[model samples]
Target chain A: MELLGIANYLVLFLTIAGVYALLTLGLNVQWGYTGILNIGVAAFFAVGAYTSALLTAPATAQPPGPGLPVAVGMLAAMPVAGILALGIGLITLNLRSDYLAIASIGIAEIVRLFLKNEEWLTNGVRGMAGIPRPFAGVDIAGWSAGGALYLALTIAVIGVVFAALQILYRAPWGRALRAIRDREVAAEAMGKNVLWFRLQSFVLGSAVMGLAGAVHVHYAGFIGPEAIDPLFATFIVWVMLIAGGSGSNLGAIVGALAIWAVWSVTELLGQIPEEPITGFGALRVFLIGLLLQVILLLRPQGIVPEPRE
Target chain B: MVELAQLLIYGVVLGSIIALGAIGVSLTFGVLRFANFAHGDYMTVGAYLVLPFYAGLQLPVAAAVTLAIAGTALMAVLIDRLLFERMRNAGPLVLLVSSFGVGLMLRSAVQMAWGPRTLVYESGIQLPLLFGPLRIKPDHITIIIGAVLLVLAVHLLLTRTRMGKAMRAMSDSPELARVSGINTAQVILFTWVAGAALAATAGFFLALDTNLRADLGWHFLLPVFAAAILGGIGRPYGAIAGGYVIGIAQEFSTLVISATYKPAVAFAIMVAILILRPTGILRGN
Candidate 1:
């Protein structure tokens, strides 16, 4: 590949990695810090993506979206996703963690089904296209220039989110969250509102995920129901969070990049094989599954273990 | 009245499959104290295992079912020994995540072995048998009978056999059961075998009724989990009742909502039940 080609691919990879980094950080807060097993990460992602797409996309006759500013759509995405997480957490948080997992997955499926079936809203299965790219209307040299600009924009967002999360992680609220996670009954005895704290973490984390989704849809210039595969978008985030060492924002970012690299490498290998495509596709997923098992068995605490107080 | 009866029968048939699947989940939760996310995949494995005997070897239906049951039971035991047994001391969350990994692997393996194309046990559909205003099929009868016999057999084993007593004792209180000199390892093995066998039976019947696909079990995963939770997480009898409730609710939901939303009904019922009575109808430990 030429130098420019390499740089282009590098920018693309970095841009995607930054988006995932946002998601991982969100997950780190929910699962790592607050001990809320949210298995429906894609639901929040979809909520954000669709919210932005409908708001920012050009006025269309079919979906009937209000062709508002992209910034407005992006701004709306966070609270929309947060409200959804709040409602779901309110209903299912009373159950055990495992039950919460099951319920969250159910909600995700329902969200996906709604996206698939509600043509008037999500444009059916075809998905909405022509989602306006950020700064696309600005005077740019070409698509490559726009790509680089988007990459920089994504990184800036990631940095902002990372810094904000780091500050929160060191705050008294974060400590109380950890307290509840480690010893809920004890925390309650200590006069901590355990459920309320957990709910706050859940809402905040999911809002971050929604922000990432809005960024993702704008970057891709399209949004679809198929775009958010839970295995890739949700479980893979879990794998990254666990592998990179949960409870650390920096660790979540590192894990996202590292796991995504491995995932891309596997995809490249699948493409190289001349045999049936499905075989390699299935093999890739199977290997990931095996990797998860091996990781859990060998290092449940992860490589960059959560720091001790 | 006939339409209601028909829906009820259809609901019962679906409930039977879910009940059989949920029993294994409940049994495993009772003995191991963790929700096995891969339980539904075991159903898929069992159904796929039968293809070799029935489709490849062209064996009789009965023979194929027997082989599938044995194979799936053995696979369950092997999985327990290889993956779950080692994690006996791990936290429930860790176990739950591992089960998810196992489920993903099982699903991927099924897709790899048998392409994504859907397959059926028999090519032609059987005409429904009419009795007064009601209509049923031979396969439906078989499913109902098979489910009843299996449930009865499980009841007998749990109540009449020594192993059954050991299992119940262990589920009730594993620490006490161990202190009382019951063979914990033996009971665990028995639990896996029984649970897997029931899962296999459910898969076989599901395949007999509907088309077989790689995602057959994955699609059923939510409903089965809903049943288990509704029935009380670790109570076998509770799962049965939960399964019927879910199935009937799902089938009857079409009257008011789109049929595509049938699965959501299970989720609604489960959440409602959990909120109203966390202990479930059976009050699981």
Candidate 2:
């Protein structure tokens, strides 16, 4: 029984880690290989989660879904987020990196406002519940096999994304992105369309972030404003990427696992009543901020530094 | 007509708060060559710093504010010395990311000390005095007066004072200023002091208007950035004008849109600016 409990916990941990790993990988495509500082990660995240939740959730759910297949909802989330990126990228990609960062923050805020105010579509702040999982009802050997099956699904998706991104990382397209990042003037001199390439990267990465959100909403069985807060959905992703080494795909995956573990542990620690833990949430933030600062200052290469080739 | 007038008044008052915040942001952006993301939290820190003096120790408002400004200035210097100063060579994006971390740290620290719940310095109902067709709160009047005085003082310091001139020189050309015998480090220190002091005042005024929460300054960050960018990056005078433009537009926008989407108004304006004139109205680099 203890072993089964431990196994269930492991399944939960890895499933969530896989979702974060997906987000980190997407971020790498933009910030890592392409050098696009997309600070509005939470916007794309919310877009993806809400799109899927609204599409796949049953009509009985608040903000009633069309009750589509889970696979269709997940697939549709990518383009919805991509379109958002396309619109924002058309305007913001031409600016300097810092300006892009601030503008991204604007987009995130706008998305948050949309989710909070568009109650008819999103069920307002109460968020839609009863989001069904793919294999949520399967049981075998007098025990539910749904947990293991979902974990399998998450791992499978991560595997596909990881493999595809790895190939892209080494292709000519990836080299062009690196060129644009390293020296935009030189890339322009070499006849590369800098703005177009950047927009493509931004859209692609954001689409992936949307997928991560879709996966997340399904596991949590709901979506809400809190799920999309920039501090959590966005800032933590940045921390994971930088902590994992930005330019490397494998590093992105490793970083997600490590950072998410630490975050989960911190939450567990916060629940202790006798530990003199006042404002545990704040302390965790302070710790992560300090961690990011220390890494940036000292070992910016991260635990799994980007591979040369 | 009355509603229009009231909105205009609200715009100017809000604009004053943002202008104060943007002045600090513009100065630092110009001199440091990076958008300090921790700037909003500097306002938060400065505001909370005053709470102990004004509310806890029961010091007079003026004295408490002075101490808070000094304390905030000192804290900014300390952060720069400890974290930012070392990353001087790390480039702007690195610095910007570091400021994000600094902002989280500052805000979380505030939460740890003050708790995450919202608090108001004065919870009593503030009755607005009728000024013909417009109703004006006394606090609004005080904020406007204080902001105008501060803005005038800043304008004088920038145009007249040697330190201010040196800072401007550095902003225009850091290397050239350095080679031309300007003490770039000293100017940087002065920039933080000016920015943090104004941010302190902005925070206090913001709290006067709304209750204090851990995320109060962060909530204002969008409009503050909008004002700074609209004014033109690194132009203090432009920032002052931009603040009013953004503030008033945001307030007036509530006529058509829900008030919760006020930040969206600023975001729309900022996007328009980015697409139409990336250099901002003043066209400063």
Candidate 3:
């Protein structure tokens, strides 16, 4: 590919990676800091994406969108995602972690099914299109300039989220979360109100995921059921969070970028000459799953191990 | 009345598949103490493994099923040795995540080998048998009978045999069982064998009842888990009852609601059960 072509792809890749970093950070807060096993990342994500799409997309005859301002739609995403998480967490968070995992995945599936079947709300499988970009009509120097601007905007969002999370992780409340995660019994005995703290973390983290979804949908200018594969979205974020050390905000960002690189490289490899394998897609997924196994076996703490107090 | 009876029969047949799969899930929970997320994928693998023998080699259905069961059992043992056994000391969350990874790998392997398209054992559909107001298929009878016999066999194995007693003992108290000279490792192996074989049988019958697709087991994952949980985790008998309830609820749901929401029925039952009675109907440990 030519230099300009490569730059465009690079900008797109970085933008997507930044969005994923937001998600990884959100997951890091829930699973890493709060010890909540939320397997419904995609559900929250879809909630945000659809919420924003429905609010911001131009009024259409079939889907019947509100066509509100993009900024308002993005602003609406966090509460929408947070409320859903609150409802789910209230019911299932008090149970064993296993039950939480099952319940979360079930919720994710329910969300997906609703999105697929509720034609009146989500346009069914046809999905919402022509979602306006952040600055669609802005005049730029070149064609690639818009891509670069979006990439910068995504990075800025990531930086703010990362900084906020970093400060939170180092704060007393964050330490309490860590304490709850490491030893819930001890934390509860210390009058920590463990469930309350966990609920906060779960809601906050899910809202961040919703924000990431808003960023993603805006960048792509579309939202659909096909946009999110429940398993791939959830597990890949997991791989990123675990592979990059959990409990560390920087690790979440690092993991997101590194895993995205590996993911894209594998996809590129599948496109190589000499008659690529017919099942290359499945093979790539298999390799990713194997990578998770290898990491768990060899480095359970991940590349950037959580810092000891 | 006939329609209700027909739905009940269909529910029972569907419940049998869930029951077979849930038995393994509950057994694993009892022994391993972690939800094996790959159990559903194992079901798919078992069904896919049978394709080579039943369709590719044109073998008899019985021989093919036997081969598939053995192959799946071997696969379970291999998985235990390589992935799960090594993580015996790890926390339940770690094991659960690892199981997710294993499930992904298995699913992808099935897709890679079989392609994304659906495959069926036989092309043409058989006419349903009518008995008065009731209509059923030979496949339904086979599924119902197979499930009952398997459940009965498991009951016998647990209650009548020495190994079964050892398993029960271990599940109750592994440390005590160890002190009592029960071979923990061997019993664990036996658990996997039994669980995998049952799952394979369920997968086979499910494929026979429906069509074989990569997502066949994936789709069943939630329902099976719901059954296992509803019957109470780690309680095999509870899983059987849970399976029937879920099956009947799902089939009957189509009468009032759209069929597309069938999977959600299991989720609803599971959530309600967890909220109302976390221990399930059987009140498992």
lDDT by residue (A51-123, candidate 1, tens digit) is: 9898888776235567788789888899999999998889777668888889888988898889989987898
Candidate 3 structure, TM-score to reference: 0.98
Give per-residue CA lDDT, model 3, range B1-285, as digits (tens): 889999999999999999999999999889878899999989999999999999899999999999999999999999999999988787888889999889999999999998989999989979999899899999999999999999999999989999989988888888999999999999999999999999999999999999998878878989999999999898889999999999999999989999999999999999999889988999876
Write candidate 1's Cα lDDT for B67-159 as tens digits.
Answer: 999999999899889888888787787788888878888888998999778988779869999989899999999999999999899889989
Binned by DockQ into CAPRI classes (incorrect, acceptable, medium, high), candidate 1 is medium
Residue lDDT tens for model 2, B151-257? 99999999999999998998899999999999888999999999999999999999888878888898788888888999998999888998999999999999998
Candidate 3 lDDT for residue A106? 88
- Candidate 3 Cα deviation (angstroms), residue B267: 0.9
Q: For residue B13, give model 2's deviation from the true position in Å.
A: 0.5
Residue-wise C-alpha lDDT for candidate 2, range A64-154, written one tens digit per residue:
7789998988899999999999999989887898888988898998888899888888988898899988788788886777888988998
Per-residue lDDT, model 1, residue B73, is 91
Q: Order the numbered candidates by DockQ, best leading.
A: 2, 3, 1
- lDDT for each of the candidates? 0.87, 0.90, 0.90
* Superposition error at B252 for model 2 (Å): 0.6
Tell me the lDDT of model 2 at B187: 96
